[model samples]
Target: KTRQKGKKKKKNINLNQSKKQSVSFVCLTCHEKEEIPLSVVRDFDLMDDGDPTTPPMFSCEKCGGRMYPEYYEGVHGIKYRLSDIL
Candidate 1:
């Protein structure tokens, strides 16, 4: 992994709207959820700001599958599912 040093900028992702400081990552294949700090996520551009259909930046450690963010809506209390497009 390449390490870059500087101030980490925050994106417009809805994680800020929540009280929790961290977000959850779900493995596409294994269905395992891992709650990771937002600082770790800021290291890379996981979600494409230009396109919501873009894939995530990281891969699963256990199964080598793709890892995507699990976005939760606080108002209606719903989780948005990341769809896979072939």
Candidate 2:
């Protein structure tokens, strides 16, 4: 029974890892809509309050851009253009 529970837990973990995230957002640099992957969400444990559920940084695969996942309050999510990286 113990071993069965362990396997079930592992399966649940895998299910969470297997989740694919895709959202369309305009590239800050190019001003063109791009599909960003959820897997690209990276954790900044030190930068944040150690909340892994909410990833703080995301990179744009198309333009090699990085920005915060801010989409609330008065400001919409800030998008970074390729030039912004420099």
Candidate 3:
């Protein structure tokens, strides 16, 4: 009888580490920047009250200021920025 070859081992991958998605945000108030998870941003959008005029935002951990995605466009095709708001 011929000897059978052993099965090859597969590399173990950490899904959490490999599938992590993040976006950079800049705080309009303090100009602080941070990397936020895409999931968190989606959750925020899901909880929003259907305000198409507003853009997704998060609180800055450093300054407690409003942080917006570095490049975001509203539903109305408007690009929002701190300078334009002020």
Give model 2's TM-score versus the native structure.
0.28
Could you estimate the TM-score for every candidate?
0.48, 0.28, 0.57
The model with the greater lDDT, 1 or 2, is: 1
Residue-level lDDT tens digits of model 2 in 1-86: 99999999999998876553443444445445554454333223234655444334545666766443333111124343333343
**Clashing residue pairs found in predicted model 1:** none
lDDT of 3 by residue, 1-86 (tens): 12222222122234445455665788888999988776776676657776766777889998899887775544456565555566
Better of 2 and 3 by TM-score: 3
**Highest-TM-score candidate:** 3
Which scores higher on lDDT, 2 or 3? 3
The number of clashing residue pairs in each candidate reads 0, 2, 0
Per-residue alpha-carbon lDDT of candidate 1 for residues 1-86, written as tens digits (9 for 90 to 100)? 12322222233344454537666878878977777665565434343354434423468888888877776322223344555321
Candidate 2 all-Cα RMSD: 9.8
Worst 10 residues of 2 by lDDT: 68-77
Strongest candidate by lDDT: 3
Query: Candidates 1 and 3: which is better by TM-score?
Result: 3
